[model samples]
Target: MEHNHDNIKLTSAEVSYLWNTYLGDSLSICVFKYFLEHVEDKEIKTITTHALDLSQQHIETIQSIFLNEGIQIPQGFTEQDVNLKSKRLFTDVFYLKYIKNMTKGGLATYGRLLQNIYRHDIRSFFSKCLTSTIELDTEVVRLLLEKGIAACPPTIPYPQKIEFVHKQSFFLEGLGRRDALTGAEVANLHSNIETNQLGTSLAIAFSQVAQSNKVRKFILRGNDIASKHIKVFSSYLEMNSLPVPMSFDQEVTESTESPFSDKLMLFHFGLMIYAGIGNYGVAISESRKSDLVVDYTRLTAEILKLSEDFANIIVANEWLEQPPLSANRKDLTKG
Candidate 1:
């Protein structure tokens, strides 16, 4: 049935995007606010300020949209969720790396959101978000380069001529010897290693400061998972004699005081788990080696199980905010 354009309502996809975006930005605001409080480097502080401003603006924009649609606004993270005065949990260099990783994730998210949105306004909003994230990513890269901390991907010698694979052995698992890694494979390995490094570092910090014993144990388990994944990815690089990316575990401080509420910390950890699954999915698609694919597939399954457990924790704690849902005709009939 054709419906009037003026009467069009928000679709489930659009509502889901908005709900997730709101939660992400709310968490970002709290994180950046805490970073701004203790950041010592002038350059890092400036970027941190810009990031916090963007998150706050996003929250306001999303709130206005929710109000207009008569949808109840999600009680996302708030001041009570963050203790800005708590001791610094990470170094300035960590902040730089965090923002850079966040920008990369934002680009991926907004790109997917743009593809899902049908309403003109929703599409336009996501387009703007994508553009802003691109700019932010550029700035972070420039700063990282200037500071000499950016790990540029390994450079390969220029090819003299075009070449093609001659046999199925090219894709076969090597028992004694293997073919050299392709640029795409190398890139995926490096990117996944870096992502897992960041996740491990964050988990370390969260584990130290988490108040609830259950939450602390869960966070520590996450740290162990991230560490194991890093090793798995790094082994591939090592077999090829490629340098592995260094872990950011040393960047975490010794402070045991909680910087964020247990609820926010749990949500933040959950978000990282979701992002990890997406990263692994992309890596598996880009990878061609049979062993590599098997490894990622297994690791992804393990993380999925952990994520399910994390969801149960959130629900038990009554911290899982419900997303917009379609009306139930069966319930309506009973009423």
Candidate 2:
């Protein structure tokens, strides 16, 4: 490969965006393709098809940019990473939920990418991706609503008067308890609970279908962790006399056949763990209750440890894909 770009070279941020987008979209294609094969609902199938199309288009666009920049195209996930012939591992409802979850993630990822990218072309491309993801998310939400499968956040009574916090007791911790929950706090709690519920269901499904014994055990452990986290979040809402989101554990099937490779399953789980940490960090920052903040801080640490263990497993199995990195100055000097 040669440096062919005349003057417009890719900055580190641009490189990162294209590289990660390519890798993620490649994996999405594999997952969506597998889902399309097993989905029975026509509406769900249509959504899956659209998702697949968008992922494939992203791959093509990313490949062109890499080629033009004289950068090596990443060997992302392929058809070989998925088993389209495998038996259905999840129910039709699960497919819809999964799409909704992934689309939400996609929107966040693209928004962050837009902030980092300075190139007009790259920004335009990501803007388009973000727009498409928004549309897809809307469609998934509509379908989930129509089918009566969406677990909406609990409604709260509208505040009648503009009130200000006048006491330090609002940030009470330990023995002291806060009787009221702010709308922002409630929203974060509900969102975290919903995310954990989905994570628990996914872990269960992966545990059942993972081929390697170690991988299966790891996934089972993750299922327990997610379940425990859900309980913690739900308890917060329950104490406030608020309803909690329902779990999707029943949406998984008893299929022992693997729909995806152990590598993909582990990688996907690792991504969820990272996302969980980020979500918890946000919750901790926005929460006024010291008890809630402490809980999120402890939970984030626990998940960080789990993520490290996951990385070790991937490295041991030679399944971890190296991300973009700067050159080692020490190594360069020795060479």
Candidate 3:
């Protein structure tokens, strides 16, 4: 392998980000292996097993990079961070949705890393990882759709026929300035990683026994979403030459049984989706290029739909949160 020996040096920030990603990937595969043990669906198990293998390979590659650079790699979290014995606590549905969101985050994060790496070998390595991550995300989505766990993006109803008004307008001319000024929005992107970690871990714990094919696919899709977001946010810090915040400060509690009530779980997910939307919105607004906005916009929409569907499930189960307003409007009207 060709290595860059020029003036190029790995900063602590860069190393930290890479280290976090390494840990994340390692944990992901380990969790998948646990999922593999209880999944009854052969096809889903096969795909997960393959994904786990790829994640293992990725960890080795990253370790090698750190070793070659004489940089001491930090020992990140592993399956030990998860309580494997707590596997009977939740429904498979909850677990799968969690995984899909996480994977989505990983994909975005890795893709951003590929964009900023300068060294030839470094760039090549990240490129390979980025491509693999995207492939896995696509596969996860496909599996979700096949199993009917994937939520379709909402579409506006269209009229059968419409009149055309061919007029030129500068609608977007000043709107970009007005809407793009979320520059002061202090979004803790690292918070996203932490939330995703907790969510995915919980999902993996339940997925061990929840062998529903639909649930497995949902978990995988969630994993992709989480992965992509991690990479995306990491890029912003890298661009500023700032540190990648890896606050695994929070303790992980394993619950195979769903500790959260169904309504609470749905609400929690709704909060995460909105959080993701805000983060991506900031990224899109702050970005100077079109492609960046386009990417964030696409992911934001996906997450939004996932959240809505999860909410739907909650409602069907009669586990929905009580509305802030009265179930009846009579009380408000009378007051």
Candidate 4:
């Protein structure tokens, strides 16, 4: 229970961000509990239990840090914000997808914080967070496989050249088909699934949380893109009888304004898009003789482009958080 306030400098915004994350962790505990009790799948239930335990531990750790600093705790969303008793309109598969997506958000947030914060105590907390979130992500994938819902994208051999949309006509006029299968195609499909999940979650969250007409319209476009990708992936998954990740849960509201700031919403979108491109790229490199890689590559390109557009919106709204860098004139640098 040692308090070390002397070493680290924290801004109000940083403090607020930590507090929000803490609250989110707390809420996730409750959300996971709901899933554990309601979900019929045993593997998913175990994953939820493990995630809940980690989130509970994180909440305690953050609370202890706040207490040490003598900072008043800010209230977070409560059961009041969630309608637990509401009838189940969406499948547990969608709930699991949402859980997976939320962990990605947590990973991005804490990973960035770990790189930026100078304080030993705070950095240590974020380090734990990053590790825990990664574990949760693994568990999620495990559950997906156990439930027979995991999508297996086809792979391709390396000797055969794979054609990508970008490499082809700018308007997607000509595409070639390969005969042999390769492992890289599976990687690409896996990556597409990950990114598609993120986009789907963002659309659902925005439909439920946003209050602005303009913002909702933007979110709607995002939803369209995500839905289209999900359909394509679902078709592939269905061929193997792999449970398709749920698309457009009725639980999410289709609204104009949101509870979160436009900046936060767009920032979250940007991070997911960034991750999406890398995930797809990995698949492209690992895919075999399958055409799935080509499809996902096209989707990745689209997501990257859309992500850049969203980034511009974030910048225009002054929502982008500037990273730490050295001044051109080092002598003038001051703490």
Q: What are the Cα lDDT values of the candidates?
A: 0.88, 0.88, 0.56, 0.63
Error of 1 at 119 (Å): 1.0
Candidate 2: which stretches are off by over 4 Å? 1-5, 174-176
The regions of model 3 sitting more than 4 angstroms off are 1-7, 11-13, 83-86, 89-96, 157-335
In model 1, where is the ten-residue run with the lowest total lDDT? 170-179
Question: Which residue pairs collide in model 1, if any?
Answer: none
Please tell me which model should have the higher TM-score, number 1 or number 3.
Answer: 1
Pairing residues by index, what is the TM-score of model 1?
Answer: 0.95
Model 2 CA lDDT for position 335: 46
Model 1, 69-173: lDDT tens digits are: 888889999999999889989999999999998998999899877887998767777788888888888989999999999976776668999999776666776
Provide the lowest-lDDT 10-residue window in model 4. 165-174
Tens digits of per-residue lDDT for model 4, 4-93: 667566765467557767756756765666556457666666777888898889788878878877766645434543444533324567
lDDT of 3 by residue, 1-335 (tens): 66655568765445655776675675566556656655556656666776788778878888888888886665543554444444434334433544556666666677656666666766677777777767776777787788875543322235589766342221232334222212222144444554555555544543433334444455556656776666775575455454454422122334435422333333344555655776667656655444445656787887887777766665676544232232467765795
Q: How well is each residue in 89-207 modelled by candidate 2, as lDDT tens digits?
A: 89988889888989878887888779888777787789999999999999999988998878787788998999997768889754467867888899999988888888889898898
For model 3, what is the C-alpha lDDT against the true structure?
0.56
Which parts of model 1 are misplaced by more than 4 Å?
A: 1-6, 174-177
Give the TM-score (vs. native) of candidate 4: 0.56
Q: If scored against the real structure, what TM-score would every candidate get?
A: 0.95, 0.96, 0.50, 0.56
